[model samples]
Target chain A: METKKIKLPLTKEDVLGLNVGDMVLITGQLVTGRDRVHKFLFNERPRKEEIPFNLDGAIIYHCGPIIRKSDEGWRLIASGPTTSMRVEMYEHWVIGEYGIRGIMGKGGMGKHTLGALKKNGCAYLHTISGAAVYLAERVRKVIDGWKIDDFGIAEAMWLFNVEDFPAIVTMDAHGKSLHDDIEKTSYRELLRLIGL
Target chain B: MLKLRDGIIELYRKVATSLPPDVEDALKSAYIIEENGSNAKQALSTVLENILLARETSRPICQDTGVPVFYVKVPIGLSQVELKDTIIESTRIATEKIPLRGNAVDIITDKNTGDNTGKGFPVIYFEETHDSTLTIDLMLKGSGCENTGQIYKLPVEELGAERNLEGVRRCVLDAIHKAQGRGCPPYTLGVGIGASKDQVTRLAKDQLIRKLTDTNGAPVLADLEKRLLNEINQLGIGPLGFGGKTTAIGVKVGVNHRHPASYFVDISVCCWANRRGRLIW
Candidate 1:
């Protein structure tokens, strides 16, 4: 699809214009959240008023990390991306409520997230999971996070400002998704390969 | 057996509550090595670097810490002081000290541990294998990989070994296809072949602990792992399914003596992070 690579610290305009085939390296604040945090946002009252972080032009990463203790405090040990589909249930609600501009995670989103992306000028990006140790290094700073202690490393919503965060466009505002294209191509190829 | 308050406890607190040594090394590597211009590569580098920074600065890496899945093999006749209690107590200590996010949910009563520890905390699996030393492999198995697990029951009369083999091929392909950029590709593929549903699932999960470069004992299975690895990569599911040839770095199949009645096969896909640590005492 004649892919183009864009370096990040991307603004809302940059993310909004991206298509499904485009690749981006985001360097900025990416607040990390997963099932519990997403659920918490959706379940909390005043859905519009009391959001956790500044949502304008921000990127949300779907991840749960493996954290280790250090003398300074808790350090992010491994935080590879998690499945993005689980957040599909809350993606639309989250984008609308938080004004989220881009979502970075593994896996593609559902119809709700797609619709929200189209309507909200947002995009979905995929990060390499299982590369937590690798990915965690790009984190420049931990801005803030919910102190929901006792929530395991995988479920906590820790926020961090990052640089050159890797991701690929999976879903764009216009309803284009690399995941869909890959699925279709793979299925077609499987049919031909298997002689179905 | 290591005392819950001492040996095993201390180890679990150390391993379960912290990130492995290699994880930090891997993160640093991704941060320094940069040649590919793809955003996907940069994304991986960023994530890995983030892990390093988190470690250096003392912060939780990416939020979802995950449920602690402890695979403990206590040797037969090896009696340690309160092994189960030790494991649980260590989990509590780690949860509090390591400050793991409480993830265990009481099936009937839903609540947060606020300390990442609670009822049925750290799903522990016990196996009495023959040995004097206990082996504890703790995996902060994320839901991303857990979500990729699948089971298929092929009709013995219809599929047979050829189709059984085909079934494995198809299942593995389907997993990669369906996963696309999901399950965080360039993942470790786990295949379980056995008689029942549970056995196959266990086999698949255990396969995650196998070395990334090693294959199963059986020649056929080894060939299958190679074939599947090649085939899945050809799908262009690359690093994060960004259309590359390295979607999966390794594939391992674990088989059990199935009851002659059926061939139940399952596949578990673990993302490249493959967060698992091994401790022996």
Candidate 2:
């Protein structure tokens, strides 16, 4: 697999060429969202003007980062992906509504997301799930955040400036998904071990 | 006498910032075994690098510092109530000093405590000891892996499992399979068997704290642990479920006698992080 370096505010053109198993070094601005974000967008259906961060040609990270405020600015202590599958039910709508081109997280999404990626020319990028401190080093600055008082730290939305952040593409725009394939293959092995 | 509050704070720092040597050793070996070009190998490499960086920086290994579960042992004539209060205060201090992510949430209000403590939060359990020494063991149980733990009521009709050791093996395998890669394997599993639900759940968590290199004291349980681990690795769920040769590093099991009417088994799965440590004074 080839390594691709991406500048953020990704366009459809940027994501269409990528395929599953390719490595990426993403640099630029991205927004962090998790269970609360997905639930709000899907259930509450906020209009474009009401939303705090831009989503057009943007990448949404499934993360709840550990951030601290200093006189200099904000510092991100630990930032890594939470499991993406938990928000599978709401991601397709979020992707289509916001013109999102990239979904970054760990433990890849499901059929709905795979379908949405194929439909919207998006891709799923899987990062090292528990490698929080190392991943935090990539965040040059914690740009801003919203809904901290309402959603709490672990479930709030935050924006960050990241450089050379690493991840692997596990789902691509062509309806290909690495997580799906592994689940099938492993299920067969499990049955065989049980003598089924 | 050692200051119990201060000692507990130190334990929090140790558990969050760095992994125990045995866990680090397992990850190092897992990295070597995974094929160089494969996703499994690459994931392990990042994890190993992260472990060192977390230690040097003294930051959390994972963003999810998780719910702190404390197992406290107090010597005879000591005040258990006072010890409980000390643990709570120490937790509040650690949350700010360690800068840990506040994880405790109010179920009714949907609000975070922001200090990692609340009504029945941090989940502390106390037991009286025989000796003069005081001991405290803490496990920072992350919800991702903790969510994957399964409890089985045996005589499983579908798996064709009976109430025997063979049946226990089947249940453990099923739990691992259901967990897949979501909990972040190469895992260390703790299995507990007993007459009731609560008994096995604690029994299993107790098994998780045992050293990976130590042999099981019971010959029969030891044999089962080895066999179950061998079978688990064969599942090919590898690091992060990306598929590789080493799916799990170790499996430990505990057994308890039960009434003839009931059989329950609990499986507690810890991810690659497996943050656990004990303090004795």
Number of the predicted model whose lDDT against the real structure is largest: 2
Alpha carbon lDDT at B231, candidate 1:
82
In model 1, which runs have C-alpha deviations exceeding 4 angstroms?
A1-14, A20-33, A37-47, A52-58, A63-80, A127-167, B1-35, B39-65, B114-119, B156-163, B259-261
Query: Model 1, clash count?
Result: 58
Report the Cα lDDT for residue A185, model 2. Answer: 80
User: What digit string (tens of lDDT, one per residue) describes model 2 on residues B151-207?
Assistant: 999899877678988889989988988888888889999999999999999999888
Off by over 4 Å in 2: none
- The whole-model C-alpha lDDT of candidate 1 against the native structure comes to 0.68
User: Which one is best on TM-score?
Assistant: 2
User: If scored against the real structure, what TM-score would every candidate get?
Assistant: 0.78, 0.98
**Model 2 docking category:** medium
**Models, CA RMSD each:** 5.0, 1.3
